[model samples]
Target: MSTTGFDYTITRTLDAPADRVWAAWTVADEYAVWASAEEVVLDVRPGGAWSSVMVIPGGARVPLTGGYVEVVENKRLVMGMNVPGRDEPVLMTLDLTADGERTQISLSQTFDTAEDRDQAEQGSNFLLDSLTTHLAAA
Candidate 1:
């Protein structure tokens, strides 16, 4: 999408180091666990591609595809996400900042409309919560 700016932004602090949190996000196996995906393939680098198949509530599989626009290990990631049913891909940015033993994550995403942004915010929150649970168990 040719969006001018990010439409939604959310931040959360995880009780783990930046490297640990970064691994959870970039490692395919770790991501699949927290994301509840049936399969995941992540190529975490600039110009790299990633894809996942998520099993929804009714056991329906939804495929997510994306390409990395920017990548900075343990620091930041920018991706162009090809969301289903959308005409254009959404631009998503994740920034990680370390604070002693904790890592603060800020996620920003662009959507075509306010409603879409609001909906995405809810989904993002759920995913972040799952990440927290996954880290706690690690």
Candidate 2:
């Protein structure tokens, strides 16, 4: 893939409603159940802060901090991510569309540099996959 693009996007059709998926992402306890984080603190509204501490195998902790730029219940969300050691914040948008009893999500993360975007892709995919599993267990 070319490193010129400013955003990297991933789309998934989940076997759950938009509201359910939205709650899973926005609620601290719910997010912790599905995400790759050992701890989560989320305030689901514009200007609110969202943070998590991810614990990798063998006990390495990686902290992530972000703030909500925009939020629309069960529909859309835009957040800003402050990557460790990076001066610029990465922007992420999550759009949800209802599809009968299911939901289709389009997630896009825009970075200041291609290197940052590329580095984030792998973990993003893992989180999405975890979401799928979490929904299935519900």
Q: How far is candidate 2 from the true structure (C-alpha RMSD, Å)?
A: 2.6
lDDT of model number 2: 0.86
* lDDT by residue for model 1 (1-138), tens: 345643878899999999999999999999998998967999999989999998877989999898999999999999888877877678788999999899999988877677888888988899999999999898
lDDT for model 1 comes to 0.89
Model 1 steric clash pairs: none
Q: Could you tell me the lDDT of residue 131 within candidate 1?
A: 96
lDDT of 2 by residue, 1-138 (tens): 235566788999999999899999998888988886867999878889989998776988989899999999999999888877878667788999999889999888866677867877777888899999999999
Question: Top model by TM-score, which number?
Answer: 1
Global Cα RMSD, each model: 2.2, 2.6
Report every candidate's CA lDDT.
0.89, 0.86
How much is 1 displaced in model 2, in angstroms?
Answer: 17
